[model samples]
Target chain A: MSGIRVSLRGKSFPDASGNGTRQVLGELGFVAERGEFVAILGPSGCGKTTLLNLIAGLDAAYEGEIALDAAAGNAAPDIGYVFQNPRLLPWRTVFENVCLVLNAPAGATALVEKFLAEAGLTEFRDAYPEKLSLGQRRRVAIVRAFAIAPDLLLMDEPFVSLDGPTAERLRAMLLEIWNACPTTVLFVTHDLDEAIALADRVLVLSESPASIVADVPIAVPRQERMAPAVLEEFRKRLRQPEKV
Target chain B: MFHLHAIWPRLASFFLFLLLWQLGAMALESRLLPLPEAVFAVLRDGFQSGEIPHHIGITLGRVAASFVLAMAIGSAIGIAMGRSRLLDRLFDAWLVLFLNVPALVVILLAYVWFGLIEAAAILAVAVNKIPNVAVTLREGSRALDRDYLEMAHSFRLGSLRTFRHVVLPQLSPYFLASARSGLALIWKIVLVVELLGRSDGVGFQLHLYFQLFDVASILAYTLAFVAVVLVIEAVCFRPLDRRALRWRR
Candidate 1:
């Protein structure tokens, strides 16, 4: 699979206050190579989610070009997205919810079962979303994203609002899954520690009318990325006034 | 098992109602207020002779046909209006006009324009109901969760799948709400339609009994029809409602 190129020169929207248009992205550009994990770190309301929307094609009103290079022998590169919420259909069972995105081709059911087992939701396959806990539901969302075997995956603070222990467990689970089946990922978060722990490269974003302020590459090895000292160093660097 | 426990209170209330009715009949001592026993006797004889069942069957059929027509057309129009600003603007005035017009006026006009035919009867009942369903479903469509829709879009679930999985479940509650209220409104309008022009059904039977001042038979037919409606509410709608909303837990 080839890398995905997103070159957004100018993307803006009309301000909700009925004022003039607000520019969310100014000359923003990046390329995520195949199997690369990139984290977009920014403060809240910094149009981080808007950038994901543009790549996912959910919002087409933005200016500039956002293109996905098709993989070899594929019509277009398949994209998966995990929103701020689990967003499962309450009426559907956990298994059926994941199956909602799968075409009924040969071996589809097996793939669904494999993903469910990976997420430790095999017992709750028939359970509805309302029956699952918040953390469990988030796990279901992650499994659903991976079940499609997407070439490019996008996540918008998928672990937000979760308790510390639960969020840590899910982050580890996400890394385990990604290690098994590497894909181009663009994870958005406001936490420096989370970005450092998850991504190979971290792109820090400015406040609203956002622009890429700093593109920092994590040099620490994968296993030591979460060490207290390494995390402290990244935190100290992110706290610097120049980066903000 | 719990259902049996729930039934006793309802049974107690029903018996209490009968006792009060019996007292009213005894106090009035007038032919106008027949005893509950007399109404029951009429019900027994009418059922044995198959006369009451025929009227009920006809009325129920008319109600079913009109209800289906109104709901199908109303939901379609409602969704269109909710999705498109132009369609909502175009139909908003029409919906208001229909809603405000008296049900009697519509029935009368339908009969006068189309004559006393089955189609006219059904049309009048359905027309009275469509506006309400449309308004309700439009609100449901507007309140749909946009985040779920965006999820569907990101996953590239096609239009049919999106409607089935994302759209329909959110709308089911509104559909049920409209249906329950619509059924209540429609049965009454059906009776009125039958009373005015129809030759069969419980409404026509009531009209006949009215001329003779046969209060017992009138009450009997009315009580029987109410029983059927209650049975529908209990047997059909309750289970469907529970199934549709079971995810709320």
Candidate 2:
């Protein structure tokens, strides 16, 4: 099983127009148990992306400790990230893009085919990412992340800006993959409804220099998450996390 | 058959060029402005005797050597400079200096320092061409999209794989651009290097013929060598560039 222990004390960047530093993340700590799905819900510019960067080890300049516990001991956890944009290597085809996430690209190509077929992208395997529609590209990105059976998966508003029907379909596919893989996931989004629909627990954060304001566990059952009445009940509980 | 649309214009352009040259030659009626037929005859004889082919081969060899040397060294420096702020700051002045320095001065410097040897000729042409390649590739590296790099980093793709897949493909356009311009620059520089120093290349032959004022032979060598370089461009580089960046819209 995969788990994470992140304790970020602070992180900052140079302000654009001033000679001062602007704090982005501060005094934030959280734990994701093995096989758990946790979503970080915050407003825009609340350092949610910055938090993901630190946890993913993309930014190692943070002030505090962020440790990952993979199923395999004494090795760095394999982290799969689904960015807000698909971010596929434009030159490589869809299949190659997924295969690139594997440690052994040549030998593990069968895994790529399997994932593509499961995601209904087998026919577009050889097509370049530029040729795919937004929904199709998002599907490829999800498939790439789950194909590796990563120790921890980080997704940053992966379904942002898609139409209603398209976003719903991709979210369904994402849940299916996560259920099968059962890896620790840290999903970041500004949309509260999305968090309520997806995560086992939603960790709410405050404005810039963000810290956890509320940690609300979704009381709705997984099968009934989409039911309008259940979602309404959950929304009332998170009605205002800013004062929590 | 489908390429006929593209091929027809090129064929017409060539004939139009020849017709204009013929008309000029007839109007001039001087020993220097020889007829196309006379130039072709000289070219045919030179080929039959094998001296022109020998000279052509030598010039092409120098061009290939210097082109490869400059590109390899230049691309490395360019990439390094692009990635590191310190390297860019340190090398920026040197790049501008070399770029401004005249090619003839570089050739002369090479001859003086390294002597009139084969290596010196190649080195002169190479140093003259390196700065341009380095500049192009440096811009390419600077313009590299962070989104793809972050993707590579988050996936923990090793340095080698990251470079081969994410980095190289992004730089393909820059590489192709450098190579195309590099080939053009190296051809002219190699000819000058041969003319200035070496005794067995097209440039040297041109020099030898100039002393005797053999206009027909000079025109024939110039035209024939231009044809060969054109063929290399069309047959080698253009297709490779198209294939390398086939995914681009």
Lowest summed lDDT window (length 10), candidate 1 chain A = A235-244
Clashing pairs in 1: none
Interface RMSD of each: 0.7, 0.8
> Could you give candidate 1's per-residue lDDT for residues A1-244 as a string of tens digits?
4467877777888879988888888878888888889999988998999999999998998767887788889897778898888999989999999988886635687888987898889999999999999999999999898888898999999999999999999999999999998889999999888999999988888887787878888888878987888888887776563453
Looking at model 2, residue B158 earns an lDDT score of 82
Once fitted onto the true fold, the runs of candidate 2 whose alpha carbons sit more than 4 angstroms away are none
Which residue pairs overlap in candidate 2's backbone?
Answer: none
Write candidate 2's Cα lDDT for A35-105 as tens digits. 88899998899999999988877888889888877576637778889988999988999988998889877
- Stretch of 10 with least lDDT, candidate 2 chain B: B1-10
Residue B32 lDDT (model 2): 90
| Candidate achieving the largest lDDT | 1
